[model samples]
Target chain A: MSRTANGRGGHGRTGGTARRGTGAPEAGETAAELGEFGVIDRLTGERFQPEQTLLGPGDDAAVVAAPDGRVVATVDTLVQGVHFRLDWSAPEQVGRKAVAANLADIGAMGAVPTALLLSLACPGDTSTEVLDGLAAGVWDAAADAGIGVVGGDTVSADTLVVSITALGDLEGRAAVTRSGARPGDVVAVCGQLGWSAAGMAVLRRGFRSPVAMVAAHRTPRPPWRAGPVAARAGATSMIDTSDGLLADLGHVAAASRVHVDLSSRLVPVADKLRDVASALGGDALGWALTGGEDHALVATFPSEDVVPADWVVCGEVRAGTGVTVDADRWGGSGDPGYLHWR
Target chain B: MSRTANGRGGHGRTGGTARRGTGAPEAGETAAELGEFGVIDRLTGERFQPEQTLLGPGDDAAVVAAPDGRVVATVDTLVQGVHFRLDWSAPEQVGRKAVAANLADIGAMGAVPTALLLSLACPGDTSTEVLDGLAAGVWDAAADAGIGVVGGDTVSADTLVVSITALGDLEGRAAVTRSGARPGDVVAVCGQLGWSAAGMAVLRRGFRSPVAMVAAHRTPRPPWRAGPVAARAGATSMIDTSDGLLADLGHVAAASRVHVDLSSRLVPVADKLRDVASALGGDALGWALTGGEDHALVATFPSEDVVPADWVVCGEVRAGTGVTVDADRWGGSGDPGYLHWR
Candidate 1:
């Protein structure tokens, strides 16, 4: 049963790769009720194939061709309680967040997403409705990014854990690494900064009025095309706003061996950030600076003038260490980013 | 930090892939002590780069080259206390089993392994020694299969979960699938059968002196080379013995629209099986036919004579439905193979 192969008989729970797709159509069936094979057949029955997917699911392994012969790959794991609460986000939203997080990482490398491998650690009692929602969410996200779900694995675990490995194509351009920033570089960002984080705070406070913030927290919409665009436009160093702007930029400053000075005033706040912060008596600017999971791309360019119109210049790289905001070292409270363990 | 790309700063706990290489020289540091980034640096500091790895870890996404313009991928997840118990196997053995299970699936596709992406979900209390052992085992297994670890993700979870995605190269050959077997084909197997299952039973019974079977249950070495070799030999159909000889063959027969009849006397049994069975008062033959996780490759050939010398013929494919033994349908008892969540 470990092989969990394709269209095999005799192995009751064997046969199929429906962790996301390669989506067979089955309705209202729990994974346990349908069995692994039946669920796989239902989940992999219909999948939107992208051009880069030389081979899709329903085999021992799916084949994907990279014309550049270089495939960019990274992975992320999300837990049930730590990453999201089932009460706060629907199954589709959870899956979308998972995909968004990984895709943003690919974007950080300035690579165009091509394929994905999704592993779902589900409990036996999980309803097929949840599975369908998750599969649909993954497919939709990949579709949005112009990629395909190639292969995956599914197993029963104590809690739901979504693990995804994303592959991307560099398109014959040099990848923007985190260690490439130098002095005199202008740090800029495209996409929302703290909407998701603010949304998270709003959700935690049980406020439903600002639906947009809550929606952003549940399903982040990353600027997918911005990756290759920034690369082509000559981004010296790049990263995704996964752990909050300052925390992420801290990584850039550390890796590039330079200091970054950010004007908090220049950091554009999310639409609902001020409202949510005011209602919760929280700092919207703090969320904008340190909130993560927005999947916004932050890059360093030699000159701010070269940055596209869509991106906003917020900081500058200098010959120093650490990250400073408004010409002073901002000693924020709490962990810079979310740490798994205490 | 979302990019979580190569060794970067400010993201206090962000950075890099650490499957087995980038062997960092840190001693006596637990995951709790080292945190995620420190562990990443120590783990991904030095990795053995295979020819296919155009860009190894220490970046947002790794780059693996597929010269054949196609890449084959599959994944598997091993859960602690479910797939294995920490007390029954060492950390290294668990990691090795994880790689072996995934590689065996890739081998079933008749492809050569090129790169791997490994994800680890463990508690904060896990020691660096355990991490080292797991990393070393993954590297050793990948090295044994002539591949490299390109990228992966690490996170904290309630329990230990190892998720591995394996990539392979077909090298200009047709992938031998289970649906190609003809009615007149012969069924053959290369490698051990009941050893691992019997080993599990022995371990559960606390018969420690019979070390080999216990070891087999802990670490299964699948015949990786046999996959491409079988593809070259023109096998009609193929599958790995991950779900027992009869159960796995039943899949092949079902997929190929044929009936497979096995001669129990013809199936190979390990040398120590009789004594182990006698001592444990268990049926060794039954174990030989139904035991799973041995990772032996079972395939259908055009004829018995055409089968490789190392493989033993045990059955024949016939124009019928279902699987039979000695000209009668074999209705074996209990689980066909291991299934999670009863």
Candidate 2:
């Protein structure tokens, strides 16, 4: 391993060649040249300590409050090639995606997010400004979710890897888990579906779309408040639309031992995607049903009660063990959903 | 990437011929064959929970208490090659080292650890038994530190990477920061020094020593209580010996704008290391002075009081900048303590 001092006072520049398609300026220096301490100082700028943060960067540990007494926690990791491609996504987008993924996990559990801790690993040639952009994205996402970036660790690696841990507060409410979906419960969704998948397709096919879909694919804006709202509305079960609608619903089915059926007509697929899919001889409905990364809220409610206006009725739970679509079992070749480790 | 699946079930196998000399059993299966859920189930087996844990694993998130209102959080990552070599340590030792590194960060803040969230990335061919051993080591270390492994994420990767986030409770005590050390404070240490570096030297040279030093390097047993004890006893500033004593103390100096002078005779150097250093044509005092990974507690106390029994008065704080030894600038060409992100 090569040893080089890095930090704020080091000889490293801030920005450099922005990978390939990221559109970032290529004038910054790599992390190795900046050194560790200098990079940390740069990352922990004035904005690190927001109003909600009791203590921010610079210390060994950061102090935040779980005023409700209960703290909710979740962790997720995004490997360079497996979870993202540096050539395809900007550093800011990668940072946002990393935070969004963990925040979605927290939202699925019916918690109000409070803080995030990040551990980032990158190659020695990685620019300090790219890292700063990543930090900017993280901060922006946390601010969007009303949380703070409390602390993080940085290291050198062959490939870029980002790991995030999100902490939340339940505020005396019980967590909504996937295991609580009862038979006869109504299934509902609170955000857009298939938009991210459609965006991903467009990106892969080297085509363009109404900027909205592409933006959705690059950085999902999860409805953070819907989590506590569902909990308050007595949601029987809950999950985020991370691994496609059907795949995530399957988790609730397997955990709760209840079958769920979804109507294709209820899902909101982009109109342009329908035309694009028809042109490509593919099914837009499949993308809406099996596409992941939308991060919409999928939940189960009692049949007798009406779901809030924000949530659309997708289907209902039945006495069974698997997920179905419009009374037919989902027999697609892809097994259930994305298994994180697999 | 060779995709051979380990068939040791969820716990992963430990024995296999392909096992590189890491002390792990050679004949073992990979983690992929066991699947993601299976591995999680195997690792968290019937562990008891405290009342503070409202909800544990198996959900999108876990709920724990932040009774004191504020939660202290820190994160650290240990990469396989950079932090530890499999040829020199066992999986259990790696697990312990990972936990210790993060816990030491929490200890530096004078907080009592509450919970840990881990994200692990490993090759698919790794045995389930290896994972089990690693979990066992994590549990053992957490138990020793009076903390809980509340939640974690697992993923497949080309190399083994463990990122841990430790949450701690201040317990109504004010956070002891590095900036708190005063010019007139007495510098003291509460645990072993140079042991881990000596063990590393032994491991690198292919030499053996008392099991204690080797174990010290493998699984450092940090003095967890010393943090809170020193805090309660009116310690003005503190930090763990993750880097060498002088280097780490230099941090306090930089933070507090005070110079620290050390007495070489007062610093603790293991006797066996002294002999080993002599044989290696090196100075044992230098190791004791600059060696890291001891996880020992070093703090500043008011010069008006006698140091506590558990601690030894090794130095004194003076009005100046940077750290010195024997009233002179102590400089050695060896490792300049631990560098973050290295």
Candidate 3:
């Protein structure tokens, strides 16, 4: 899952100082004052490493167990003012979002995460509180995935950029790539769809009371386990909804050389999302169909019976190309999905 | 190995437009004009994937063979103004430098590299020609290492950032970590030492001739095979010289809780380096001791007999703390080692 700017806030958002469980960093000591090693020590020291970590930090490189004889690897980068803002979200939240993006990509391949490597480049004057919060958030999210950060590099840059590489073990299973779907397969999805986009919309409108929506925007909890579950249930293809449901499904469609037609009524849109859409004079269904960054797992199963209980069947794959809703092109209000640098 | 300012030009250095083997991009099309997937296709399409790569690009994640049941991983980032100036070095050279840095770290662990993941973030106005040069350079370097570009993410940012993650296989050997040097071990190094520093000095003085020196500063060729050779020869600890000789050895000293005392006469300072230093009026020995980014492999062996023939013995691990030259602290003209943001 790649970080993309939602249509609402097209960059340039700031927020308050971040506070994390690890406590604020050394009374506002900036990264420059702490120096590189000091910052590294503060971030990596005392963190729990899982069994997969044969070697952790304080070395030239880290060794991780790839028990299945194969490793799944992916990388994603988040740049401040481009993918996130210090004012809109806490440093910890940004950290979680970074990890979530890469982990979700690993999950999309039907692999269980093993280790993560973080390379952070930020202005020297960045407060330790923000750095600590970012590290704390990364550690917390990594813990949730049962993985640990192995090795990383820290450097100085004019901008704050967080790049993460997530490694995963496939558990001896064939990877569920986007090209595996067939014309007869059934399309399904697991986890939240438009909550992040809705949250971003609320945040753009200057209303913080819909805290749940805003939090979802800040830290998306991708359905990490659903990927492997779908793979085990004989999924034909899978991808995460980083670029909205229709847009992500389009990738599967193009790669699988098949057409996807979703039943408009079957595509789940939450009641809470509808309420927010109405209050903001927005389209909840439109957001659910086209907004990105929710990181929901969408996959295609050979038949309805093979679709797992956790996945909601939303569409059918047919012989053709492109994606459609109710047998026609999606007449959504916004673009099907937004790509960076466009 | 991390990128550190060499203390000469500080940061502001610029050069000419990049031209690489793949040919310049179509009429200087900017990345924004091509969009994200288009850029991905251009950078990744038709690239070679070595046998270790089970799945290459155009996927949620790439699957790589980890024949040794474990994977060695490391990450490094190079920022445009911070690590390299596009005007001084071509995009291809910057790409090669980024890969070289991470691969050197993997080699320091006594592992054979298997694959690489690149996360590139640059301004929307960056020309596709530069992007193509970077990709070509990355592919060329990966080819030399017998690996492939497995997966990556491309995004738009205010500055150009190239972050790479390299993975390696240990081939059943124990990883040579930083904390394993013994008190009686002899320190040896393989590959160029002060050439990069001299090259940087030459560039800072606005003289680009002495082509070899400037090239060395642009692209370091780490002795990748020497790492495994040292491991087989019973080397106890290893590190790459990203922060010069004395500074990197200090890491080994602190990690192993041993003192490292170098014999000044035994250290190999190349004749060409002396020639460059003479012309530039710079101290070659000082540059060799304190200048960084050469990425040479330095290791500790039980004794001279077990040291590989290709390595030159320059120092000994002693029963004390801190690094010294001829049993005394180095009186180098500059900092013992430079750290980013210091």
Candidate 4:
């Protein structure tokens, strides 16, 4: 049964009366008083549906059709303090980031996201407004990716944690995996790099910056369409710039069995970050290479084909098994790439 | 990128190795010293995969094929102390419970589980042995369900939280939903009911029970094949008895728009729970009606057909929109099914 805000008489809102006849607590009452299952029923009371969903909440598992014969799925979790500080990001930002992180993964596979299932754990003291904002954020991100929130679960816990599973459709296209790159392919990028990392540095250092990097850290606006576009354009390999650009590129290199060389001169580092880098006494090149969470699209394409408008050629794949800088190993004097996980 | 304990040249017998291939820790290295991404890489390396997995960990998302065309998916989260008590259940049991919960959802969908994606959040102090045990539990459960651990994410958090996403394949059968039950259909149940609840009561009230009930609470053995069998038998609707029997049956009643009448005598309330019920001055019927987490399959079949050997006829569907006990309305005589979102 689909739910709508303006639905039938059963459990519909009574005019100006905060209570419904479902034996639940009044509107302002605490969730503990109403209990977990009761709140779940109210939250899911009336919701719209998309044709892809064969089943939605109230069943053991939801059935969604994968008509294209292949499904691309990814999961990510964002914990309160470790991933996002409540003081720095609103509940909406947290929700958006949680969805964005996983959506980026689906994009890496060159698939169009279809649906999202979110599970949230939060303290009882959390305001309902916060929950509504989080839901709005999830919906906004899903809308950006042309997907719908098919189902979710909410539970009370000591800290707030958001885990999202994103499912995608390949649209009959072969998935562009990281291992497809070969020597002589042109390496290009379609989105900003290191912006989120710079923003995180600013946040950690408690310094205000004139750059939009601060906003980038709060919500990453990944180029969603670039994935399918690259797949259609014969891109050889692809991955999202999640961990620092160099770290993620290293993954592509290892998987593809090819060395990738980046030309620093071709990278477009944010000008606003120059001042922040100076203020923090950090190298912009290091931030560009080692900073993570940018959600940028890094892809390899055949050298003969003209690069797309949104993309900038940054490097080329070479015959090796690791990443290099300007055709040299990263340890050379001028390179600032490669930060070990430790 | 498959890794095995004896195959990889990193780490000693103890699991506390750094990502940089450094020598094993001197007995007590903290996870903080090893770093976040490093621990993730190590844990991913330790995880094993089954054949159904086309691509396992190391990719943004592991790929698994659903040759059957349809996919059944479910997600569930376990919070420390609420869903499980760390003192009562070992980390392995926690892992098993998490997998069991999601796997049971797949079973309720009348599909065969193929793969699982696990997301774990834990405090930094958690030892590598504890994590390994947890992984072993996940692997064990996946093995039991004939599925593989295809992908997962791990992060640091203040409390332990596990979220599992299970994917299943339906072999060309129409998905049996809760809304499909018609009037005059017979209600039948497969597997044990109220066992987990009974065990929980024993643990909560400091009473003892048979090892089977305690094991049931720790790791539920869901009737995995019963769902697909019911589907093949042309059952109209089905659901897993996660929440109390009546509460879950009420879902079928409300969804199907039919009254469901259950004969209390048909419920399999374990004999071990009878003495504990008397000790707590509680009615076993209350536990049978309101107890949750049994993970049993309850479905409606055409009354003219014979029920399966694994299932017992419990009641029948009537032409109304409510649930009853022995022909009396639900919530009568202080016998209400568990409430939702409480």
Residues A1-342, model 4: lDDT tens digits: 001111111221112211122223346444454456544544433444466766655566767777766666678888887788878887778778888888777777788777777777777766555565576677667756666565556677888888888777788888787888899999998887877877877887886564488888888887867888888888998888777677678878887888899998886677776777788776777677767777788899997366677988889998987787787666522223222222
lDDT digits (tens) for residues B1-342 of candidate 3: 000000001111112123234754553388888777667666666567777888777777888999999999888889888889999999999989999988888888899999998888888898887888898888889989988877787877889999888999999999988778898999999988888888888999999969888999999888987899899898998988888888788888887889999998888888888898889888888888877888889999999999998899999998989899989888866445556676
- As a whole number from 0 to 100, the lDDT of residue A208 in candidate 1 is 62
Model 1 lDDT per residue over B140-214, tens place: 788788777677767777888888888777887867777788988888888888989889889888766588888
How many clashes would you count in candidate 3?
A: 5
TM-score of each: 0.90, 0.89, 0.93, 0.87
- Candidate 4, DockQ score (0 to 1): 0.33
Q: Please compute and give the TM-score of the first chain of candidate 3 against the native first chain.
A: 0.92
Tell me how each candidate scores on DockQ against the true complex: 0.50, 0.38, 0.39, 0.33
In candidate 4, which residue ranges exceed 4 Å CA deviation?
A1-26, A29-34, A38-45, A204-211, A275-282, A304-306, A328-342, B1-38, B41-43, B46-48, B205-209, B272-282, B304-306, B329-342
How many steric overlaps does candidate 1 have? 22
Q: What's model 4's lDDT at B293?
A: 78
DockQ of 1: 0.50
TM-score of 2: 0.89
Docking class of 4: acceptable
lDDT of 4 by residue, B32-55 (tens): 544555555445454445666665
Q: Write the per-residue lDDT of candidate 1 for residues A158-216, one digit (tens) a residue.
A: 88888887877788887788778999999999998788877877777777658888888
The deviation in Å at residue A200 for candidate 1 is 0.9
